[model samples]
Target: MKKNDWFLAAGIVIAAAVILLLQIFGSVQNGLTVTVSVDGSLYGTYSLSEDRQVEINDTNRIVIENGSVVMEWADCPDQLCVNHRSISRDGESIICLPNRVVVSIEGTDGKNEENSLDGIAG
Candidate 1:
């Protein structure tokens, strides 16, 4: 390849790397709680300061430890949520589409929480 082409390619790679880094570092914040929803309805919220395991509708189990929450078990066929990484930052979530369950990290200080529904109606 030409020198100018190589430089352009390097510039693109650098820009991509910078954007990735910003996304990784920018979204991280100390979340205060973990919220769980089932089938688009509000299930419950648990404190992150204390570690524990939560069972949602007997279909999914989540373990909160070390200020991070992870899906420890799920009865769904794919088990994608069970293998998801632990989330401690606000806005991070593990969604189980098959089970219609969503587990998300949230902060109560009024910054991380935005436009969230206060209740769900059938």
Candidate 2:
């Protein structure tokens, strides 16, 4: 093949790889958000389910209860919300970085809590 052809092929391959990575990340999860609010102050962000952090340090010292929703995981350096924990009820989630994903528990698209209890939904 010509040199130009090779270069073009390589470019296309690289572009395709980047697109695939984005798609995969976008589909990483499908949950809800549960923002944490301190004593009249806005905390960080978090997602439902997943074993993430709810607060950063003991400076504020906040926590969640039976209420199911997003919880911020403010410990990791990167702080990217991983699969985190797994929520199924009305509120439950994981958090990281400066984000806060919330889980509907009733399904991301709005199905029902029972449906999402198992794990990732369809």
| Every model's TM-score | 0.71, 0.26
Q: Assess the local accuracy of residue 68 in candidate 1 as a C-alpha lDDT between 0 and 100.
A: 91
lDDT of 2 by residue, 1-122 (tens): 79999999999998778665543433324455445544435555544544444544442222444434333334435634433553334333343434332322333444434443323331
Please identify model 2 stretches exceeding 4 Å from their true place.
30-122
lDDT of 2 at 1: 78
| Alpha carbon lDDT at 47, candidate 1 | 91
What's the lDDT for candidate 2? 0.44
Q: After superposition, which runs of candidate 1 have C-alpha atoms over 4 Å from their true positions?
A: 1-28, 115-122
lDDT of 1 by residue, 1-122 (tens): 79999999999998778665654544535547889999899999999878899999889999999999999999999999988988887667899999999998877666435422221110
Error of 1 at 38 (Å): 0.7
The global C-alpha lDDT for each of the candidates, from Candidate 1 onward, is 0.80, 0.44
* Candidate number with greatest TM-score: 1
